[model samples]
Target: MKDAEKLAAFCATIADERKADNIVQLKLADISTVTDFFILCTANSEPHLRAIADTIVRDAREKLKVRPRKVDGKPASHWIIIDYTNVLIHIMTNEMRELYQLESLWGDAPTVSAIKTLRKKTPA
Candidate 1:
């Protein structure tokens, strides 16, 4: 699939699982030309943070036929990174989010945020 499609599908699945809020997918094509997109989202707690990371990993593999090469930062919910060759998903708590602000660091990318609210569909 195209980078845009992979990103939209990834973000949508995360939203569907109710593991994200104010989600954003940034196309990091220019910055080192490493990944195509960087999917970012915030969760409430450690469990919720894991839930978000897990859902995205599962969905990308199951639906998109893509798997992350490595996963990190799971011990605590502060931040989690799932590294797909063409995309990287970041799941973080609100506090960590404000502190390490990825958007500011990668200012040149196009960040796409979630369209609808992902409020009440508790994790399975």
Candidate 2:
């Protein structure tokens, strides 16, 4: 996998560890210049959103040796975006996710199966 793909998968894994819901990774390389990939997931509440975002930032930095170039949004806003340049992590509350419908907004972008990526990177 490319470095960005690996990073996205790792962030998704970290979010999963925090019990984030409906984790998704969108491939936007061909469709958008904003980023190569987008990792979207739903957090149950403000605290859950904070925990997932914090863990992703902490683990990605500590384990992957990378940090987000910038972060936007906030837990109180029901969304948090961790921008890694090539991969943007979107952590949102269920309501916000449903309201914004990022999945549909970027409907043209293909979805990358986070579970499949994780399995391929894992050793037997």
The estimated TM-scores of all candidates read 0.80, 0.89
- Look at candidate 2 and tell me the lDDT of residue 31: 92
CA lDDT, candidate 2, residue 117: 22
Best by lDDT: 2
Question: At residue 61, what lDDT does model 2 achieve?
Answer: 85
What lDDT tens digits, residue by residue, belong to model 1 across residues 1-124? 3865555555556655674775777777766477777777778888888777777778777877777789989737489988776777788888988999987888887765544445786699
Where does candidate 1 stray beyond 4 Å?
Answer: 1-4, 75-77, 113-124
Which ten-residue region of model 2 has the weakest summed lDDT? Answer: 113-122
Global lDDT of model 2: 0.88
* Best by the TM-score measure: 2
Instruction: Give the per-residue lDDT of model 2 (tens digit) for 83-124.
Output: 999999999998998999998989999998644222233576
Query: How many clashes (backbone N, Cα, C below 3 Å) per candidate?
Result: 0, 0
**Regions more than 4 Å wrong, model 2:** 114-124
